[model samples]
Target chain A: MSDFVQSLRLWFAPGRIKDEGETPDYRFSLANERTFLAWIRTALALVGGGFAVDQFLPDLRWGVRVGLALALLAAGVLCALRAVNHWVRCERAMRRGEDLPVSRFPAVLSLAVAVVALAMVVVVVFGWAGR
Target chain B: MTEVRDPGLQPERTRLAWRRTTLSCTVVAVLAVKVAVHDDITAAGLTGLALSALVWVAFLAVAHRRIRALDAARPHPLSYRGALLAAVCTIALAVCGAAMIW
Candidate 1:
């Protein structure tokens, strides 16, 4: 628990980066930040979807509805968590004149989206048929 | 901190990304606010509403500062503080959203 708090502290400590790393072109860091923001938007979208699932699918099996919503909410949390880690790692790599770490998030997130889309499609099909 | 003669448009593009992301966050936050308003305003719901707006403001502020730094030709690596701020805000949003939902 202490370690986790420490890690959180470290993550939040912006000034620690003051003098580290060889200063590269400003564009690199800007691009990295843009990528981080994009992930955050993705997470926010998932949360919005969670609300939509909970609200619109009144006829959905409560179990399935809740499960799907929870999955989406959890995925959003994962994206936020990963966004920081990726940003920091990428920043550190740039500072050290090392290769930026490859991100696997896009693939994972796409798969999650596929799962959600498929679930929604099934739900829609049934809803249309029942109507 | 030497200025690179050819900084290109990447910084501008990145700033644009920040603007888009913050805009999306704000929209979602407003949606959360709508949900809270429709329901009885619980503490969690209100907190989510406030935090959502706060996150957007904070993100814009930091992005602006960083972009300014870029424009000023001080090519510092992106601040870990800014990254952490984004992370904390984004995660707080998720947590507050859960509070509203749950």
Candidate 2:
């Protein structure tokens, strides 16, 4: 438990990663940085989508509008957290000469997005049919 | 130690990615500001707008620094503090965006 706490405490230290292992290839590190930036962009997109749905869909039922927006916002929060965590893990693995850590987060994020898209479709279809 | 080669233009790609993400962050901040202004500005709305602006500026600084860092012959690994700050800023912007929505 203490070890975990210590590592967690060190996680945000400026030079924690450098102290672990030899600096890996600079190209690989740059690639990791790009991946992190891409994830940040994804998070931004989700947040923007949430705001658009809320502002533009004035005719949407209040409950449905807030529900959809909240879903997107929640996803954005998760994606942002995952972005930083994954970046650190990948960098540490590369420095240690180990295989890059693999995760199911991409699959999970895709599934969440698909589910949200389906919900939007349903809302649009039902609203249109009623008109 | 052998000097690293840069035939793949990795640093350039990374720098571009930072710029793109910064642009996206700016868009999100702008939208939040629009929302705050379009509606009657409540205290909460004003607070959220201010925070969104602050977070956006912080993120821009971090992104700008990283972009410049990429120009080095061999850029250092991203510091833990920098990545954490960037992530915090992005998440905070999302919260501000949500605040603007409802």
TM-score of 1: 0.79
CAPRI-style docking class of model 2 based on DockQ: medium
DockQ agreement of candidate 2 with the native complex: 0.73
Which residue pairs in candidate 2 collide?
Answer: none
Residue A60 C-alpha lDDT in model 2: 91
Task: Identify the leading candidate in terms of DockQ.
Answer: 2
Model 1, span B4-99: residue lDDT tens: 533576656666776787677776666667655665877766767777678767867876786676554435556677776776766666666666
User: Least lDDT summed over 10 consecutive residues: which range in candidate 2 chain A?
Assistant: A3-12
Identify the runs in model 2 with alpha carbons over 4 angstroms from their true place: A1-10, B1-5
After superposition, the stretches of candidate 1 with alpha carbons farther than 4 Å from their true spots are A1-21, B1-7, B39-44, B67-70
> What tens-digit string does per-residue lDDT give for candidate 1 at A26-85?
677777777888888888788777767777677887778878877888888899888887
* Top-scoring candidate (TM-score): 2
Would you list the clashing residue pairs of candidate 1? A14-B81
Please state the interface RMSD for every predicted structure, separated by commas. 2.0, 1.3
Provide the TM-score for each candidate, comma-separated.
0.79, 0.91
